[model samples]
Target: MTKLLFLVADGMGDWPVAELGGRTPLEAAPTPNMDALARRCVAGTARTVPQGMAPGSDVANMSLMGFDPAAHHTGRGPIEAAAQGLELDPDDLVWRLNLVRVAGHGPGDAMLDYSSGHIDTGRSTPLVEDLQAHLGDAVFSFVPGIQYRHLLVQRGGARAPEAALDIRPPHDITGQPQGPDLERFASSPRLAELRRAAARRLEAPANTTQANAIWPWGQGRPLLLPAFRQTFGLRGAVVSAVDLVRGLGRASGMEVAEVPGATGLLDTNYQGKVDAALEFLARGGDFVFLHVEAPDECGHSGVTADKVEAVRRFDERIVGPVVRALQGEDAALLLTCDHFTPLARRTHTPDPVPFLLHHPRLADHALPAFSEAGAAATGLTLERGHDLLPHVLERLRG
Candidate 1:
């Protein structure tokens, strides 16, 4: 049997920037390990986002994990809720309530920060608790999650005119006026009232990232997924610091590995995640899905150098160690990004991202490096991201 190691560098793809002489962050970063692997691995591009779908991490990730988003994804809210062990009723409505920083108390103000300065869990928890205490009742409840991400669920089959509302992801509209989006939901009196109440009650404490309001989007009911083992005929494990990834793993019947000091940030515990992936494989697991979120966060902040640094760190700290450990072992390793989080746009795009698949038995068709430019130059592209897994399986078993 061929052991599998699937690694994902979230939002690592970027557009060319003038500062880097028109090279994307991945191209600019000095990723020697990735470059070496590219020399011996199959390099190509894969379109993780389907047509007409939002290029959010949830949709992209689902596609990367070999599930067709159109067939399986309900919404991000339900997937995140699943990560927190929250069971949803058939009629329960779950929405992702992001702690955000707006310019003013009124909706007319611009969204200053989508993640409320990437609010720490300690500071954001109290606010979520307070909201639950003050605003939560029989119909609505607030559930705290990692950092700025949280959940708001509406029970009793109370629909909130979601179809009529123009709710948008806070990250997608950062630095833009939010009044128009808020006004679109004015038809739903209950939602409007809840929004005002949340804004009035939540205030950021001094000297901390300002999480002054809750921006709700990505609403949906719960969903069920076919087990990963049944779908792929391989027992799998998932390692990630983010809830959405962990939730997807749990929902798909994969073991969710937790690593200490894993913060899902630039300073996250890269060694710990590497250790977990190796440990899972050592324990007779068939596959491991390791995800790193730092690159995407850096892209969202529009920091080019930081994004480059993130890619380098992923290449050195995570990919290098895993590649070294797999030496002399019958394993197939795959490294790729789910989608492009371009620093220029400071948001996700539906463009195809680069992927590298390596196996000891296969011949090397080396490239100069594993990057957007190099991958595109190869002209080997997977039109659908979901096809990647099947392709990997074929290479492993062929």
Candidate 2:
């Protein structure tokens, strides 16, 4: 039987507002189409693993892909770096850099938000080039992305384990405790020294610019793991606009297909995204993971309308096509979010997310159409993220 799993990690905080006390964009927004699908499927909420702790995109995605995050999780820096086309050596260490405004103000002014807001890649690329000139390929190398984001690669030499030592927090946003411990920094020293130097340069009023702010985050390297094909015994593919998701898919022995003309914005190529998934499925992929960034980006900006609109647009454009592809075929379709990117909170919510499964031979067309409110009433009950894969596999067998 052909099996397709269309997973939407609909960005942070995308659940219904009513369910989470009116704090999420997903609740406040209109998603008539998604609501309709929930009606005819086995719907329920799935709790993300490890409980209460804040995990990066890599950990969260690994959980949804049916790998135990605790066992397979390495870090987000490596994942994002990979997505950005940075290669890694087992001896090398990679760190994610954020383009942040290094303001010398009081605690309130100390951190100005909009630090390289959006993918202002134009401003970011120049800043990266400047930094590269300063480093000059010594023990450390600087890699740049759009404004406020970059990657620092440390050449493995005499700095084997020590290369990872003596680092400091890149930003005050995480409220990292004030300390001199190198071990406390997110990444190793080769990258940490470069970050500190860059921050100092940006701290000077003359060096800072509206879109040239620097802030680095999500630090780690490619973790060794059994290929997804070997572990699950299933041929799979991943389609996404996120670099980290794509990089991880590539590392795990799966085809990371690109959606033509896809952009990481509200105006992304939705039809093209669906078409790519269909193509991958036709090419013999039994497991397919699709990612959308609309809701998440809105949450980051705290934009309620954009978040809601993104979700609706995703449903109308992405969902319909995927569902249509599965109809009358010997296949199973499952839908869900990775984590909640609530607009109200402007961060990821620990709340369990709603998911549904539909098999063609099932006896219930009486189920309601997909919607957040209807999913809550499906009587499917809630479980943790780790159980999602097993549950979907069972439905595929039926």
TM for every model, in the order presented, reads 0.97, 0.82
Question: For residues 1-398, what per-residue lDDT tens digits would candidate 1 score against the true structure?
Answer: 99999999999998889999999988898888888888887878899999999999999988888999999887888899888779778778888899998998566689999888888898889888888998999978999998999999888432545633548899998888887777865767777788788887875344255887888788887857789999999999999999899989998999999898888899999999999999998999999999999999999999888999999999999999998999999998899999999998999999998999888776546887888888877788899999999988988798
The parts of candidate 2 lying over 4 Å away from their true place are: 12-24, 84-86, 105-108, 146-148, 156-193, 200-209, 363-383
Judged by whole-model lDDT over C-alpha atoms, candidate 1 comes out at: 0.87
Per-residue lDDT over 163-282 for candidate 2, one digit per residue giving the tens place of the 0 to 100 score: 444333343242232334333443455445655676665555555465333444455556555687887778888888777677678767788887765656788888888887888778
| C-alpha lDDT (0 to 100) for residue 30 of candidate 1 | 88
The most accurate candidate by lDDT is 1
Most accurate candidate by TM-score: 1
Residue 393's lDDT in candidate 1: 92
Q: What is the C-alpha lDDT of each candidate?
A: 0.87, 0.63
